[model samples]
Target: MELTLKGLHHVSAITAKAPENFKFYTEVLGLRLIKKTVNQDDISVYHLFYGDEKGNPGTELTFFEIPMAGHNQDGNNSISALSLRVPSDEALAYWDQRLTEHKVEHGTITELGGRQTLSFRDHEGQRFILVSDENDKGVAGGTPWAKSPVPAEYGIVGLGPAHLTVETAEDTAVVLEGLLGFRRKGTYPSTAAGQPDVIVFETGEGGSGTEVHLEERNNLPQEHLGRGGVHHVAFRVDNEEELKQWIERVRTVRLPNSGFVDRFYFRSLYFREPNGILFELATDGPGFATDEHIEHLGESLALPPFLESKRQQIEAHLKPLDTRP
Candidate 1:
């Protein structure tokens, strides 16, 4: 069965410390901490979900904040960085100075594809970029980055396409087009987003509004997976059965994968493209509210059904986020 895979679901990463990771993304970057939970297998560590107010699938950037994990070095065969787009070029200037005033080391604002872009690292060297564009609809946080030039009304539009540097272009292309069903869109002006010659692809109608990109950079160092690095890139599938079809298709290609792990909210199937970048296929169901009440989500430690017995011990091990901090 040729499953018509949907677009990107969410990107998950590993963080060194839960408290610090929470602070940087929520307090500094202004993303909402939507769910506070633990990994079912390893209850001692926290599985934090950050996103827009409701934790929509595409808007989320999940984390496994395993305490005491070492920092990871980023290179090719890894998701290099996540680019978030702002409302306009004017917003880029706003974030640039705001990052500087906060002592958040950021590269100078530079023009790419005729649009202004700024790059900065989180406390863990997780690089983030903000590009000013009119077409993006990325959700912004409830609170604005204090130095934000754009008002909360027009904060970040949405996740701009995530960029990845693969080991080889051809191998990666096969997986994108043949397995993932992504078509090679068209080349656009690098000045539009200040990017290198980016090769675009999409489920359909690719544009600033909705699309994902695979920018191949060869001769790069291999990416190490640990603290402050992307753990996996997930794509959306219709449901569990559809996901199963994908699982079988991937196996037919002789790809190594971790089949169907129950992630509490969604079911996940993970595998690597030929270039060795990890990809996840997840169902869009039983979301954040599956356990906790929507109104009071992310307030306490949540456990999956199988691990509910360990809730108390998990709570005891977690270092309280002191959300007010």
Candidate 2:
């Protein structure tokens, strides 16, 4: 079967403080906490998923908590910034004012890649840009959370172009195009003085949700991955059968990758491009609602059946997180 990746599935970042991360994303940013669970690979830390009302495939922005992680030392060859899609240019104005009222650090609204954008940082200095969907036309954005503190119009709707900063653009570009099926879109000027223009790439339906912006900066140091650093970016695959086909494609290219692995809510395949940026291909279904009622999601600790027998031990290790509304 022909293999094609849909678009941005999710972007996982690291955080040192889970409680602060929860308050910032859910209360200040107005995203719905769709799942409160532990990292399957390490069971001791929390893996928090934040997104729209239902936590749709393209909307999820997750974090893996590491209480002792150091502050991020930003540099090259990393997923530098993450983008969150808001409704319109008018919504950017609303967010600018809202962020100020909450004492959060953010920048004035400006244009990037032919779209209005606002740059900001989370508590841990996790960089982000809010892109306006005013005239966007590809991979539709997800539904906003009805209970979000911010008006639905101004609430974050979905993920957008993940900004990648690397040492050699062509190396990463080749992997994106040759290996991942992304097509070159266009270029935009870089904010850094005397640097080359940033190249844009898109996959699947092609819009803010399906784009990646790559920038080459040979002078920057290798990034020190820690709290506030993005862990990886995931692309959407239709199902397990399609994912199996993608695994073969990656293997054919001779890239080391994790064969089929189940995450309960979805199945996934992991690999790293030549530039050392981790990439994942994830299935879209049996979603978060599989183990909990739609309305009760994120309100309590949720364990997959594989971990259900060990819930007592797991809960003991977790810090109490009361997500009650």
Candidate 3:
């Protein structure tokens, strides 16, 4: 069976403080707070979703706000950084000034694979990059939030290349190529000794959100999940059938998987790759607008049917979030 992931569905992470996380992404970064809900498994914690106006798949970056979680220890078997795409060099310059004015720590523009990138870190020390792509095909793929402080033309064009740290690229490379239909685009040498070469891979049409760069760090320690750590990175599939096909594919290869789990808005199948980074394959259907009206998204606490009975209890426990634009 042949399969090609459309792009990233969403990148979910843990945040130590809810207010700080909300301020950075929505206020500073100018993303829309699309969904306000609770974690399905853990009702005490908040599950917040930020994205473009419509809360599209590739544009989403969700978080589990765990106020007491410790800082993450960076190492192998983890996603190192999340990248977002911008329209042009002018847009990059606009972001450079915006981040500076906000006193967000960021680096000057640098070229990576012929694309200009601005590296930065969030308040919680999560690494990120804003890469410029003049000919971005996904520009019209998402709707920009009308109330974003940043101008519409300079708004984020969804996720870009993500950096993954692995112990060895060989086994992960095999799964990426053999199962996920990713092709090696290029490679670069590591800057330090004992570090393995960096391998770049791409799926779909190969631009912006479709790229995944793998860095090998054999001598590094394994990562532990906490605040600022990636919980899981999800890839998009067209519908339920395609989702099922992937589950079969993973099982055929004898990979341990969480078979068909309904995530309310979308169905999901999860499996840890050979390198130990958790990956989720999710469907792009019945999105964030299913329960709430489009205009009122993220305005109130939305709950799935199973959790509706406990809405009163859950609401009492969650910190009141200010999600205004």
Alpha-carbon error at 205 in model 3, in Å?
A: 2.2
List residue ranges in candidate 1 displaced over 4 A. 111-116, 136-151, 188-196, 208-210
Model 3 global lDDT (CA atoms, 0 to 1): 0.86
Clashing pairs for model 2 are: none
* lDDT, candidate 3, 190-231, per-residue tens: 645867668888888677777788898878899887898888
Evaluate model 3: give its TM-score.
0.95
> By descending TM-score, how would the candidates be arranged?
2, 3, 1
Q: After superposition, how far is residue 116 of candidate 1 from its true place, in Å?
A: 4.6
Off by over 4 Å in 2: none
Q: Which has the higher TM-score value, candidate number 1 or candidate number 2? A: 2
Candidate with top lDDT is 2
| Candidate 1 vs 3: which has more lDDT | 3
**Per-residue C-alpha lDDT of model 2 across residues 1-325, encoded as one tens digit per residue:** 5567789999999999999999999999999999999999999999999999999999999999999999999999999999999999999999999889998899999999999999999889999999999999999999998999989978899999999999999999999999889999999999999999999999998999999999999789999999999999999999988998898898999999999989999999999888899999999998999999999999999999999999999999999988989
What's the TM-score of every candidate structure?
Answer: 0.85, 0.99, 0.95
The candidate that achieves the highest TM-score relative to the unseen native structure? 2
